[model samples]
Target: MITLISSDKRKFHVLEEVANQSLTIRDVIEDRRGRRRADRIILVTNINSKIPEKVIVYWLRHFLMPEEIAHASMSHKKAEKLKKWEAKFFDTDIDTLNDLILAADSLDIPSLFDGACEKVSDILKNRSAEEVGEISKIENEFTHEEEEEEIPSENAWVWRNEFA
Candidate 1:
């Protein structure tokens, strides 16, 4: 087993095989294969305790069905089930999703990264500009004049509505 220490000093003991889903952890384990047991402790300094817990949950879920997923031989029903499961798993607030994205990227877990990114995109899609900004907690810094006049004038083609 390898111990993953979160930034908040929480320790998660994970089987090497389950943790191997993370390329970074796999590489670290590979590099310290013959070392003492102390080497098995990996400090994930960039991610807090909550994220690691979520990541571990994600890893465990994927680990349970890696072969079925990788082989492309899973039954249609199973695929649909897994898709539904993923949708529910990723249905979280934007801040948590963003944190998951960063943790996944840092851990080199592409599947998790992709899933979290897709969730974030889904939350933003087809929304008005103000809605998107509000959901994402991004302040619109442009003043009234800049928004109504300067920006539209600068990007005239975008505001033309000719296609519509």
Candidate 2:
């Protein structure tokens, strides 16, 4: 088992295999291989307690798989079940989702990072720039003239009545 320490001093105990899903944690473990598990504590100072707690939950949910099962093609039923679980897992508020994305990126967990990115992309799809900005909590920095000229020119298809 590995003990992960969050920035706020929260401690999470997780299986070494599950924690190794994060390359950063894996590196730490490897570097401390000579030491006992009890002596090894990975301090994730970049992320706060809440974010690391969520990350630990995500890691546990996506725990270790056998090498053969990991590499081989999954059955449709299993695949669909995993898809549903992922959808539900990522069905969080935008702020939490953004935090998850950043945490995943920092931890070097590609699957989580990609999943979060896809979820954010789904929210952005078929939405106007204003809506995207609102959903992503980004202020529209473009001037009115820039919006008028660039939006229609670059996204003419989105401006069409049928598309809208």
Candidate 3:
């Protein structure tokens, strides 16, 4: 078992395999393994307690199975179930989703990072640039002339139809 210390000093006890999903945590564990300490504690300084808590939840949900079982093809039923779970996992408020993305990236958990990115992409798809800017809290700095110059006459129809 490994004890993860959150930025606010919250402690989470998790299985080694589950924590290993985080490459950063795995490296810390590896470096400390030589000491032969019965209990291992790793401090996550980059994220706060709430973010780490959510990350731990994700890690537990995606706990790795045995190598053979993991490599074996999953049945359609299992695949669908996992898909549903992923959808639900990403069904969070925008702020939380952003925090999760940052946490996943910092922890080097590729799947979690990819999932968060895909969720953000799904939200952005089919939306106008203004809508995207609003959702992401970014101010549009392009002037009218710049916008007009950026869209060529040939593609103006396409752009108009897309944003219409």
lDDT of each: 0.89, 0.81, 0.79
- Candidate 2 has its poorest 10 consecutive residues by lDDT at 62-71
For every model shown, what is its TM-score relative to the native structure? 0.88, 0.81, 0.80
Q: List the residue pairs that clash in candidate 3.
A: none
Better of 2 and 3 by lDDT: 2
User: Per-residue CA lDDT of candidate 2, range 29-139, in tens?
Assistant: 888898876777777786678887878777876774432554487677876777788899899888888889888888899889999999988888998767888888789
TM-score, model 3 to reference: 0.80
**Model 1 ranges off by over 4 Å:** 67-71, 143-145, 154-164
lDDT of 3 by residue, 114-138 (tens): 9999998898899888898989887
Clashing pairs in 2: none
> Per-residue lDDT for 152 in model 2?
69
Model 2 C-alpha RMSD to native? 3.2
- How do the residues 16-131 of candidate 1 rate in per-residue lDDT, one tens digit apiece? 99999999999999998989988898888967898889999989988988954646788888878878989999998998999999888988999899999998988999999989
The order of the candidates by lDDT, greatest first, is 1, 2, 3
